[model samples]
Target: MKDFIKFLRLDSLCGQLVAIAVLSLAALQCVNYYAVYSIQQSYASEFLSVGHDYLASVCQALAHMSAAEREDYLASLDRSRGALAKPFRFRAAEAPEWETETDYYKSVLAREAVTEILTRAGIPPRDVRARVLYGDSPEASEPHFAGYVFPMMQMLVQDGGGSWLELVQPLSVTDRRLIWRQRIFIMAESLICFALVIIFIVRAMLPLKRLGESVERFGANPETASPLPERGNYEVREVARSFNKMLARVQRNLTERDNMLEAMGHDLRTPLARVQLRLDSIEPPELREKFAANIEEIRSIVEQGLELARSLRTSEKAVPMDAAAFAASVADDMAANGGAVTFAEAADCGEPPLVAARPTCLRRAVENLACNALKYAGGAELSVERRGESVIIRVEDRGPGIPPELLEKVFEPYFRVEGSRSRGTGGTGLGLTIARNMVLLNNGFLTLENREGGGLRALITLPALKTAKIGEIRS
Candidate 1:
């Protein structure tokens, strides 16, 4: 049922409006029809009563008249029939023939209304009119009779002089035509009014469209400020104000969290530095070296945690750098320092890409992967690839790979693979976590996985940008 309603467009604003308009039009038609029908019925009843009364008046006058006077009265009645009343029509019957004088009176008095009146006067019409009149010489013709009855009498007039009367009440042509025209005009006006209302609603809803756009942008890029207009209808303005307040609260909370992490990492580093100094001052040479080594490793861990916090705090204002060349230089520097790190352009590379990033932060990320590989895998191969809208810097090695189950655990602070955090390995176990935090702060992602045959592969993907045109490059 929900799907059917969707297909019928019932959920949309425009569809609801059209449905309301249709129901209103149907209601209007019913009301118009009933009102017109009631008025016509009333007019018909009144006209019918008036016609019956007029018929009776004419019948009474004919009954009291002499033969010569009756002929004159019939002619006058026929003439006056045209003008009897408004919205009524009348017609007189033709003359009749009889074989005898008594037959004429009998036929005349035997008509429905005439017999009724004569019977009341103690006369039987059938006894008087006994003969049949064959009017034509060869062809037989039906006899005609005349009678008068008023509108109220509801009876007929019968006589040889003027026989049949027709009284009719028909709807006026002018009134009927006007009624039809009015219905047509109402329909036309309704359609036009409905169209106007729809247009007004759409225009009024424009502000809501803009508010929706603002909401989507706020969700998409929370770090950027987009102030919503506190204007338009009351509901719209209220929504805008609420959205702005929410954005402000989210930004403040995030900022405060980053600051707290930075402060804790900074305060811890001072004590760690003091401990490293004390370890160096131990009396026994071999024991002092071992103790010094332990304290320095602890200090390195502290520094890496501080770096991660700082990366998050500074990424929003980080300076831009050429990401491709920067990655290559880090690899070359590690190799020069006696680490087995090799740098090469990818087969699918283009001119170096630029990125909105901190050079020091990005360099630290690539350096951490190289050092991790040199420590465990003995060497690593580094390359930069330019993908659509992104730069992918990969560091791959050939050594015992990290266990599949522990792949994600390696990036957690102070986490190391089982048996890989030995003092002989000389690692603080915070390198990969720091690298990942830096990558994330720069609006990128860093992934770690085993290469096809053996060893770990770390790939950092950053949003790609075009290299600056000549003068646009910063020194």
Candidate 2:
């Protein structure tokens, strides 16, 4: 039962199709069975009524017969009683417990028509036995000859400890024809109903299942610009409407918030710059030196703040570039900036297998990570290599690594590991955040781990560009 429920939850197109098909087929079978049952009941009742009328006509004639004529009638009833005849030739088979031939034929004969028919047919009592084979029990009634057989049916007597009414019910050729005809009708209707159900359910559920998947994908990446087809039933349309509205709202709010933060950072920088200029002109020997140093520190703080804010705004779109050359360029740029930066090794990565990315942003991200290592750990080991379908740029330093708990949290904005009481590092605590954002924008990832030897190792892996164009870019 648990496995069956799990199968129903499978969201594949084929699975959903099968589920709908099965449900539809079952419903059709139920409806078809009920319809055929109703038809059987109507026709069976008609058959019973006809049997009763036939008995009535024969009994009426027997009532006026003389005693000698009644003896001959009884003789005829006895001879025909054992004959095999089809009672209902044109009727279809009934499904319910009461809809069978034994019920209709036996019950109708037990009515007043049987005796009247026997007498009308010149049959007398003590001539023929009234044998009723009730589905509930089976026993033959006693035979009477040359006597009033009408009283035998009403005797209420028990034979073999069970009650029975005997009548001659011979099966005719028409009975066989009706049986075959009814069977074919019921089977044909059942098959047609099954087909209709499969068709209806498959058509309806196919789109709904696809729409559910589309909603999942949209939720996974709200920035995805691929639009879903606005087609299907009302419920699907309503769901799509809600999804699109929520997506638009999220995009709008994020855009507005980023714009506000960027604007504020830009506006505040000019005032900070003006304050620095005023402090530099102060000439008090002792007071001026302290004030100038404080003003310069404020300027640096403001610059870092603005840089952090700008990095948070994810505006970089990825493009193709040479991983080896990009890594080399970063190291050389730092070397030119008077930093002791050196590349441990470099190789072509991405595609077959030159990795593609936004060259400038990736270069800046690698440089920032290297800067962090050099600032705290005093120089670093930087290496670029292909790892499966990604380019892994690793920077390992010899200085102390962050605590284990703080490793993941370091990516959060302004999450400095050092306590407030300690002398803080020069960084504004946004370098890792910027690097992570850049990696994500390039369809890559950045992870930090404690080196076995000592210090921290930052690994950046970006998707390797596998297409022909990546090779061209690398060349």
Candidate 3:
């Protein structure tokens, strides 16, 4: 049921269009069926009325004719019957089967109509009888129309000689097969129209879909978001034009901000360098050491502030890389630097877990997590694995885990846990913030959770590249 709902995607425009089309078709079919049924009822009623009048006239004409001329007159009338009209077969008999089975004919309307017409013509109602017979009856030899049985009217009138005049005529009614064929044709036509409408609507809305995808891509990595084509309807084209203009403005603003930060860093570092040189000439060694420590802290803060700004607006182009190999490389580099970081290889899968990432930015984010573990926990373990369409990179430590409430607060810039994690550990409080921004820039997610027993787990989830795309990249 969930899969079916997902497939419908009623949240989207295309799904709404399909739903509307189906409902319209259903309503139209219902109207069509009612119209066909009403028309059949009206036509059948009119035919029966005309049939009663014609039968009565024929009986009256036969009453006036001599016994010898009656047969000749019937023959002439049969010959004059139109091709489209049903022929009335007349014969003189003692007692027909229809007369004996009077109770079997259950059509009260037809019998009453025949009796009324005969009585008005001066013939006694007792001398005239009418019955309806279906084509399937044993006494009826008439063939069916398109495999459908129709009722035939059988009438009997007693002449002056007391001989019974038997008349059998087919009821004028619409064929069931023809009505079904018309319905089938209408349904086919409606389906064709529905398909054409859906195609037109989808094509018209295609530009909107592309625009939404472009916006999402720009949010993930502005550098990789290309300008959308200014085609389709006028409104769509205008929206694309506006989006392109916005992208240009944002890029310009980022560039100007970077230039301003670079200038400020250069100007501040010059004065800080001069201060370091002057600190060496201080009288007391302890006072000089304290001054030097403060200056170094200031310098670290300045550099980290610049690094945080850079992480938000990376110009690095993302490329597909093996996540397992990348995690291992980071771990090996940290181990070489005497950080006590261990690399755990993932289980051998048929294909390497590949993710699209900016190498420098992603590496810095991973390194920040590892460094935090090494500072507090004294050691860190790095591992990578593929789970479904995502590649997960985890940094685990056996440190005293953070408080549940403060776990999310640590990600906020300049916010630090004061209990387990103190200011003495020395962080500008922007490490997690910077890491999260960098991961988001690569369209990945980073989350911190306390491990079982005692420890903290830093997990990064990146979208895995398809095997086909990996082959294209390698080629």
Candidate 4:
């Protein structure tokens, strides 16, 4: 059942709509066929009812006539042409053969009606027998066309001389051509209905598809993503409008928060500077050193907090850059800043290792990782490689790795491992959080895992730009 649903693509709205339309059409066709067949049967019964008197008169004549006269009369009826000709046949037999069983209720009703007609013709009902015949019956040689079968009736009556009279007539005069025409008409109507239904469904769902795309883009980069257009039905337009309103509100809130953080940093830095200037009046050298260190820590916390806010709202445009060269530059910069960092050779690939990203933000994220590794593990090694459609930039170190349980918790804002909380470690606990945010801003992923021997590995995976060429590099 699962495989069948998958094959039909019933998980999607369009597939379900088409399936329902087809099923409804099938059911309608079945009902139409039954209705038409029932109507045809009703017409046949009415025809038999209207012709009962005429059939009784013929039976009366045959019962009284001699065998020779009856033969002449039947020959005259057969030889007559056009409107004068009767659409029935007569014959003489020694004994009558009546059908013992039949599946059609209409056939049983036809037999009973014919028996009543014979009784009215002065013939004994016990000596009269009747049966209904379809095209499949051996005694029925009725013409068939276009796979349609015709039905007929046969009746037998005993005469005074022990001879039997046989009569045959069509049950109904339905046109074979007419049945085909009706079927073709039904099929064409069903097809038109199905087409109209599909067109309406697709048009109705188009706006929803666009809305989903806009939502995904906004989630990836809300600062740059455009608002969804309010077009389509009333409900769809309303949804788009609501989403645009929410997006604007979120952007406004973010702007206000960033501005507040910037103002706080500015307001707190001036007072801290005044305090640092006044620290020399403490007299004792050790106490003076402690006061200065505490002031510096406070300054560091303010700067890191501002940095975290800024990372959330970067406006830098992304461009294609070689991932290998990018990693090399970051490693070089970190080393020049007196941090032990090494750049490893790029992995061999047929094409240039390019990725689309905001260069400044990506650099900041990688620098944060390298700096963290340097502070705790004393050194860091950076490497770049292309893995399928993604470019990986890894910063690894050889130090006591984080506890397995705290790996993900370390990425939260202001979260620190047990030993790294002291001022000597020199972290405001926002470095990893800010770094992850910066990477996410450029549609990249940042993850931390424990190294095999004893260390932590920070991996950044960015989507590789296959369309970028070496000539397109812009420093």
Scored by lDDT, the top model is 3
Q: Which has the higher lDDT value, candidate number 1 or candidate number 2?
A: 1
lDDT of all predictions: 0.64, 0.60, 0.78, 0.78
lDDT of 2 by residue, 26-112 (tens): 687667667656666566545545655554443444456675675566466555642533332111111212211333444345444
Tens digit of lDDT per residue, candidate 4, span 1-475?
6633443477777578778877887799889878877877677667666555555666677777887987787566545522343445555555855552367665566557767777766686546556676777765453421222346566666666676666666676555687778778778887898778767776777787788878887886576557888999999999999999999998888789889998999899999999998998997999999999889889999999889889987778888888889899888887888989999997578877789899999999999999889988999999998988898999999978899998899998888887754346888789999898888887887999999999999999998887734346444
Lowest summed lDDT window (length 10), candidate 4: 141-150
When sorted by TM-score, best at the front, the candidate numbers are: 3, 4, 2, 1
Question: Model 4 segments beyond 4 Å from truth?
Answer: 1-94, 99-105, 108-128, 132-203, 206-226, 332-354, 381-392, 420-423, 452-454, 463-475
Root-mean-square deviation of every model: 14.2, 10.8, 6.4, 7.0
lDDT of 4 at 167: 62
Candidate 2 residue-pair clash tally = 34
Each model's TM-score? 0.47, 0.52, 0.74, 0.68
Instruction: Assess the local accuracy of residue 299 in candidate 3 as a C-alpha lDDT between 0 and 100.
Output: 90
All candidates in order of lDDT, best leading:
3, 4, 1, 2
lDDT of 3 by residue, 76-182 (tens): 66556533354445556565544434565434566677678878889755466677777677656634223333566666766666777666665645566877886
TM-score-wise, the better of 2 and 3 is 3
Q: Which candidate would rank higher by lDDT, 2 or 4? A: 4
RMSD of 1: 14.2
Candidate 1: worst-modelled 10 consecutive residues by lDDT: 146-155
